[model samples]
Target: MSQNREMKLAAYLVGTGIHVASWRHPSAKPNTSIDIEALQHLAQTAERGKFDLAFIADSLAINPESHPQILNRFDPVVLITALSAVTRKIGVGATASTTYSEPYILARQFASVDHISGGRAAWNVVTTADATGETALNFSRDKHWEHDHRYERAEEFIDVVQGLWDSWEDDAFTYNKQTGQFFNPDKLHELNFKGKYFSVKGPLNIARSKQGQPVIIQAGASLPGQRLAARTAEVVFVHWDNIKEAKHHYKKLKSQLKDFGRNEDELHILHGISPIIGETEEAAIQKYNDLQNLIDPYEALKFVSGYMGNVDFSKYSLDTPAREIEFPHVNSIQSNFNEMKKIVEKEDLKVGDLYTRFFGAARRDGFIGTPVQIADELEKWFTEKAADGFMIQFPLLPNDLEDFVRLVIPILQERKLFRLDYEGNTLREHLNLKKPKNVFIQKTGASKSYSKI
Candidate 1:
């Protein structure tokens, strides 16, 4: 590996933690989900650790069985916007569904966040993960759009949003006070885009921000999802249980970059990892087991059932091996279903074990270790090309996150694998990603106004 190569990290900022039983943890403040101060502290903690970004994941629909974080939470964008104001450097990103969102409005919202945060903004584009069609009902649709169909619309949705983002060139916003003129008319261009899924006209109201444009982050691992990320994403999030699969997926995505007229350097592949760190390996094991023991079998089954294409695992004998049953066709989060299937076949996981197995990512035996050991695993992955960086989903908020920052981060920094101090001000700078040029100016040289009187 080149000495210049460095690991990028994003703190996955869920209120309690990523684990399904996190809310029940002894130290957990269950109401942290809606507590702005608590969230601000988390974001600040990530910033204090010099993380590249603080990310929040979202889903459109929720039920009685939904995880505590999902059941009651601030809208991700709005929460991030608030976090941005309190913190100065670490980037703030949130998930937004391309399926249910209007391109124009979503474009404006993120663009505004970029400006508000002085360009430390990212949009984690996702097609809604509503496997049960419950989200479709929320949107007044009788059925959820098919998987491929959602990605098809997503491709167009992203284009429209990007088009609107390019409405004004970097120099277009010239607020001349002495002169009557405000902004260069010639530099502003209207989108006037017409697509199979949407038709949007004219430029966005907001101008480009400090980083030129908000960073584009994506996390879909399906074929269509991969295609979308290859063509458009600057940062791609993925999850894998083992290094071999992670490396294979990493190489595959990087190779696809060329097919989209991009270079491997232009995009980053981030693997999602939830680390359970302790002063000693044994301490980590005990901590991991403590959280695992908190798992409510019923709630875990309910959540897993929804993810596994809404299969009602409750119908099966809890003692039944998952491999013995036939799973229905998954219409949502195909990558998740595919991964769960792999685990079911490889392990003798009974139906009762499926939920914890999936939610745990089997971390008790994997990333649960002392700081040096955890750092060693991270170094191995980064050096071996298994991942460009990691999206850390700490098992418990504040506590687990603080442990990683206080213990593991310094070791990685000492080895020159991670930055001791933030190298740049914006998210793009932190990741060493290039700020995208205004597409309108790139194609037309001089922007042509598309406004009609």
Candidate 2:
């Protein structure tokens, strides 16, 4: 891809909230996060901005240990479906865990969303993370699956889901009321999928979705995570605080695609980013600073510590330099720990400062500047191949989204960095990915080949 046309940006909206504590600021309408009208407006705003998709993150088990103030309510797929009804364009992507779900049920849910949305849905595959309080939620036991095992199950789970999706041929539905037949029996095939973790019987009740299957997205940074993403994900979400690290991951991930016998273009790498933009760089800085004041130092510290593998930093004084503290092994999010270490060593960050820095860095790559400066940074990342695009998150709800759509998007449009209008109805078509062939249908002689370009 040409540098000018390289990056593809999408907006991330999780529930009615963003990933920042600053969201409770006076300017924020906290109540609007769950409001249907508010969400519809946000979706429309994203479409107007010419963004690629509206992404939502999900967790099967809520973290009770975390501050109660942080957890908010809304089912992702349901919310996306609601938003889909209000908007004509823009992809609707939601995170769904493979470990907690059955393949047949999930396939139907996503396929139904695709049909309702006219092929704008995408599925972000995730393995459930371990948090202590989830035992009551019907998790098998108090223990979380070993990292490798969870991903192994995820791989098989995805296979079964895809198989079920292909159970009916594209032309299987006849709607022949005159003949008293709703579907052609000969065109349907049974999955009979028996995997290590699950055994699913037969065809999905719904017809093949408009996109064949919704676009697959993954966000695994570990070895197993990366492998799953390389083989199955069409869009890979990455979190890298530094440009060099982001570039390295991009290259390595794209290289892994070749080993999977997949084309590199079939997968897109999108770095998570938090943008605080303004008319001028100084104004943007002021806005970012103001938002930082709302941060509860204790809350920030606790969150960062857990993210760095549940390493307790309470032993160190808040004023003490970060380097003085010895780090311990954190099983969860190992890459995040390494990145945090680099930031501390390079910047000589103190414990107090670490919380503030981490607040911005942890959500997405922080970009605070004038529209021109933000655009220039985005262009650099795209041109340098540091990221194929970004998953843009706003610290403040509507205001942050409003500013980006009004200011930053216009600059990108002028530079031809973003689309002025959507070119296709389906998410896969928008991303330039070919529709996947139905595996079951191919086996039944309803289709000649199962591999789709």
Candidate 3:
């Protein structure tokens, strides 16, 4: 069998902020998180480093239980769209929840971004699993949709979104100045889609994007989540703290794709990772320790407890073993909790030590070492089939990212493991993906029964 090519890389940014305490960092700017100029600089730096894409994560509702550190920021779609205007080459991707958004509106927004970015746009498809606060705020109801029901609605949502994207044919818009004709009316389509969850009518008002459609990315790890990804996602984001577990997940996800008649190469599995790079291993370790020391024990405990299914750790002693605590439920985010259990068990960590470990591992897999060492580890994961690539999350905003871009990226480029320059213009082109056909056009004028509109 032929081996896969070198892994691709992307940078993951969470709203207007990097570290939980990044705002407190002496050199950090308070307004950098939401400042357009700062974001433009960040995007340019990533492009200069030849990164594949700059990704922004989103959540519909805020967790009141969490800290109020760096959560305030701009909406992801609006922010990424603004970033697209400033950067020339970097792929601009953002998240939108299927549960909260209408398919027609989302299709227009994503396609608009793709056009504004000159074909460099992607949408991270997420089902809003926890929408209690959002429902209360938006719908005047506090109830959230059940897990299975959310996925079911998501299935229809995906269909509607894709159908809407296909509603406008490639040749639908032909501005013939001489005849004063703006569009070919015959080529226009109406998607009268009526599903169990939603009923959307008519063609999207926007033209087909430069890349035909924005790339679809998914990052759910539940059984239903994996199934959804196998069917619809082109890029799947994953998180695993251990190499062995990551490989297992990669193999399982790949195999599941085969069952759906999809090629393994069609889905790119990118693991989430954070690297603390230094001139030497000792320096990197020292930096890691320093960051760990900066964390507030009480805050770290609260974060970990929520991640572990909201188990209260307030009563537990600092030296209490994690294994002794009984968990009530293992729901959608079990993989994360399971990984925490493994770490605690492996290190024989007490509550305090585990809290510190959890703090270091939040939103990322920690990789602390010298520049060469970091590159070597990444190369191993790529070569060993552990991952196709990584979504890098920086612990501290520009500083951590600057270090990786300046130090480790060069090492990887020297080894010919990473791109020295971009190969294509659009996100699809950069990822070597073929433009998807407009499904509506394929079956148009077929039957009256099919043409409800």
Candidate with maximal lDDT: 1
- Cα lDDT of model 3 by residue, 329-367, tens digit: 544354566667667667777777665565433323437
Give candidate 3 misplaced runs (Cα > 4 Å): 1-4, 15-19, 67-70, 130-138, 330-334, 338-347, 359-366, 443-453
- What is the C-alpha local distance difference test score of each model? 0.87, 0.77, 0.76
**What's the number of clashes in each of the models?**
0, 1, 1
Better of 2 and 3 by lDDT: 2
Candidate closer to the true structure by lDDT (higher is better), 1 or 2: 1
Q: TM-score each candidate.
A: 0.97, 0.92, 0.91
Tens digits of lDDT, candidate 2, 275-306: 88877877887777777777776667776665
The RMSD (Cα, Å) of candidate 3 is 3.1
Report the candidate with higher TM-score, 2 versus 3: 2
**Cα error of candidate 3 at position 281, Å:** 1.2
